[model samples]
Target: MKSEDIQIRDPFVLPIPEEGKYYLFGSTDRNIWGPGTGFDAYVSADLAEWAGPFPVFRPPADFFADTNFWAPEVYARGGRYYMFATFRRKDNDLLGTAVLAADQPLGPFLPHSGGPVTPESWSSLDGSLFEDEAGEPWMAFCHEWQQIGDGEVCAVRLGADLREATGEPVTLFRASEAPWATPYVSPRYPDTANYVTDGPYLFRGDSGALYMLWASFIDNTYALGVARSASGGIAGPWHHQPEALYRNDGGHGMVFRAFDGRLLLTIHAPNRTPDERPLFLEIEERDGRIALAGRTSE
Candidate 1:
C-alpha cells in the first residue's frame, strides 16, 4: 500500500507462503479521540496495494481496559499464532504486556495467559518473545521510564508452554547505556533526563550473529538502534553499536526476508502519533552487523 494510505504505528507484516499473501498488522488510531476499535490486518501480494482491513482482534465484552491497547506483534510458533500486545489497566493506571493466541495470522486472537506477564506493581510494555538456541522461550520487554527515571530492557524465561514467566526478570540493559539512545526532554523535568525505550525485536542472523533492533528517541527524533549479543546467544553480554541503524524520525523496526532471498528491514518514519505509515528498506549484513542497503521508495 502507498505509505500515506495505511494508518498505523508499530507496523508488523507476516508473509504466509502457503496462502501466497502477506498480512500486515499495526496499531490503527483515527485520531487522539480514543483507542481504535480493534486490531486489523491487510493482505497483499505486492507491498504497494492492500486488500482489506480485516478485523483480527477485538476487545472482549469483559475486557479490562479500553484505552492504550497498543503494539501487537504476531508470531507463528509450533503450529499456532501468538500475539504479544500491551494494555493499560483502568484501576491502577499501569501498562503491561499480555499474550494472545489464534490459529491463523489474521486471527480472532483471544487471551492465552491468565494475566499480564510483567509484575502487577511495575509498569511495563512492548513485550517481544525471543527463543534461544536451546529452544527455550524468553520475553524481552521494556520497563517504562515513566515509572522509573531510566527505562530498562529486561529478559525472563518463559514457561515451557509459553503461557507465563518462570522467574524474576533480569535486567539486560538500560536505555541510557547506549550511546545512540537519548532521553525525553521536557520542561517538567528541567534538570533530570529520563530515558525511554520502546519496542525490542530479536533475530539471529544466518551467520549466527545475534542482533536486536529497538526503538528510542534521539535529539527529539524517533530512531532505531542495534545491539549484538557477544556471547552468540539471546541472553547477552550485548555490545551496543556505535551508531544507530536508522536515525530519521522513525523507529519500531522488525526484520523479515522476502521470497527472493533478500533481507528487509521494515519501520515507519516521520513518527508522529497521528501520522505514521509503513516503510520498507532493503538491508544487508556486513562484518557481523546489519545496515540499510537501499530504500524501497528510492
Candidate 2:
C-alpha cells in the first residue's frame, strides 16, 4: 500500500538502520472503537511507497482482550523486538497496556507480559517504552479521564524482563496542567468538564534534556504538545511548554530519527476514522525542547 492510503491512527515508526527499512505500526483495526481483529504493519525503505499490512499480532484464542486494540509500538532490546500495546478486556471492559514479543521487527507477535503491566483497577492506554539513564525500563502511559476527572500521564518502573510492573505508577502530570489543554465535552458524561491525556512518549533532547510528548484537546481539536523534565529524568518536576507544538487536528505522536539522521515526528491527522492517515513532520531538538521545522514529503 502507498503510505497515504493506509488508514491508521496513533502512527508509530520504528527505523531499523541495519535492515535499511522503517516499520510502521499503530492502531490498525478497521473501527478501533469497537471489536478489534488485531494489529498490522507496513514497511518502507524510503518512507514513500510502502509494502504491507503485515500481521504483526493476532491474538491467540484465549487471549485476555478482544476489543479496542490500540497503539502498538515496537522496541529492540536484548536482541529481540518487544511490542507494547493497549487492549480492552472482554470480561470487564477495562483498558490497559500489555507487552507482546516477536523475533524480528515485524512478526506474528505473541503475548509476553501475561497481561497488562498497568494496575488492573485503572483505565490506561498508549504505553510507550523508555529506558532511563541508568538503563531502567519504564512504561509511560495515560490514566484515562473516564476514571478520573482529569486525565493523567503516569510512569511505572518495569521489571528487567519487561514482563511486569515493578513499582506503583507515579503520576507525572495531569491534562489540565497543560496551558493549552481544553476540557473535553462529551455527551456521555454531561455534567463533567473532563480533560484528556493520550499517547505519552518520552525521549531525550539533543542537549541531554528529558522531554515528553502527549496529546490533548485545544478548542476541541486533537493537539500534541511538549513537556520538558526539569530534573532531566522521568521522575521529574515536568514543565509544559507555553503552547502546543502542533494544534492541528492531529495527535498521538512519537518521534524517530530517520535513516539520514533527520528527526521526524509521526502522528495520525484529522483525528477521525477511515480518513485518518499517518503524517510525518520534521522536528528538531533545540536547546532543551523540540520544535516543528517543517513537514516531511513522505
Candidate 3:
C-alpha cells in the first residue's frame, strides 16, 4: 500500500541504507486511545511505494501492558534492532516507554527491558533514543500534560543494554518553555491551562549543533516545532525557535537523511484518528536551524 492508503499516528521511519530499504513503524492500533493489540511495519525502496504490514511486534500473552501502544521507534545498535515504545499497564492506568528487542528491523520484537523503562509513577510516552558524545544511550520522553499541568520533555540515561534507566530523569524543558506553545484547554478541565510536550527527537547538525523536533499546540492547533541546544548536547539549556516548522494540525515528527543524502522528515498529518497518515518532506538546515523544505511523498 502507498502512504496515503495507510493509517498511522506518530509515524517513525528506520532507514537501512545497506539494505536499500526504509522501514516504517508507528502507533498502529485500530483505536490508539483505548486497548492496543501490538505494532506493525511497512517497507519501501522509494518513499512513495511501500510493501508490507509486517507484524514487527506482537505482545506475549503475559505482556505487562495491554493498551496505549504508541510511537514505536527502532534503532539498530550492537548488531541488534531495539524498539522503544509506550504501553499502558493493566493493573494501574499509567503509561510508560519500554524497550523491545529483535534480530532484524522487521521481526517478532520481544520484551527485552522486562517492562517500562520510565518511572512507573509517571505518565510518559514517545521515547526517542539519543546517543551522547561518549556514546551513552539516553531516552528522551514526555511527562504527559495530562498528568502535570505543564507537560514536560524529560530524559533519562539508559543502561548500555537499553533495558533500564540508570539515573533519575532530568527535566529538559516544559512545553510552556517554547514561545510557540499554547495551553491545551481540555473540556475535562476548563479551569486549567495545561501545556503539552511530546515526541522529543534529537538531531545533530553539520557544525555539531544539536536540535530537537517536538510537538505541542499553537493556537489550539497541533503543530511541529524545533528547538536548539545551546551547549550542542541533549541535556541543554535548550532554546526554542520563535516559530513552528509545520503548523496545520499535524505533528510528532523525526528527521532522517535519505539514502541519496537529502535531509527529510516524517510526521503524521491532521492529528486525527483513522485519518492520520505518514507525511514525508524534504528539510534543509541552515546555521543549525531546521525549516520545512516541502512535502515529498503523500
Q: Candidate 3: misplaced stretches above 4 Å?
A: 294-298
Candidate no. 1 TM-score: 0.94
Report the C-alpha lDDT of model 1 over 210-241, residue by residue, as the tens digit.
99988888886788988899998867888888
Off by over 4 Å in 2: 294-298
The per-prediction tally of clashing pairs is 2, 0, 0
List CA RMSD, all candidates.
Answer: 2.2, 2.0, 2.0
Which scores higher on TM-score, 1 or 2?
2
Residue-level lDDT tens digits of model 3 in 233-257: 8889999888888888899999888
lDDT at residue 254 of model 1 (Cα atoms) = 85
Where is the poorest 10-residue window by lDDT in model 1?
289-298
Q: Tens digit of lDDT per residue, candidate 2, span 13-71? A: 99989899999999999899998899999999988788988988999999999899999
lDDT of 2 at 296: 17
- Which TM-score value belongs to model 2? 0.97
Q: Candidates' TM-scores? A: 0.94, 0.97, 0.97
| Of 1 and 3, the candidate ranking higher by lDDT | 3
Error in Å for residue 268 of model 1: 1.6
> Which of the two candidates, 1 or 2, achieves a greater lDDT against the reference?
2
Off by over 4 Å in 1: 187-191, 294-298
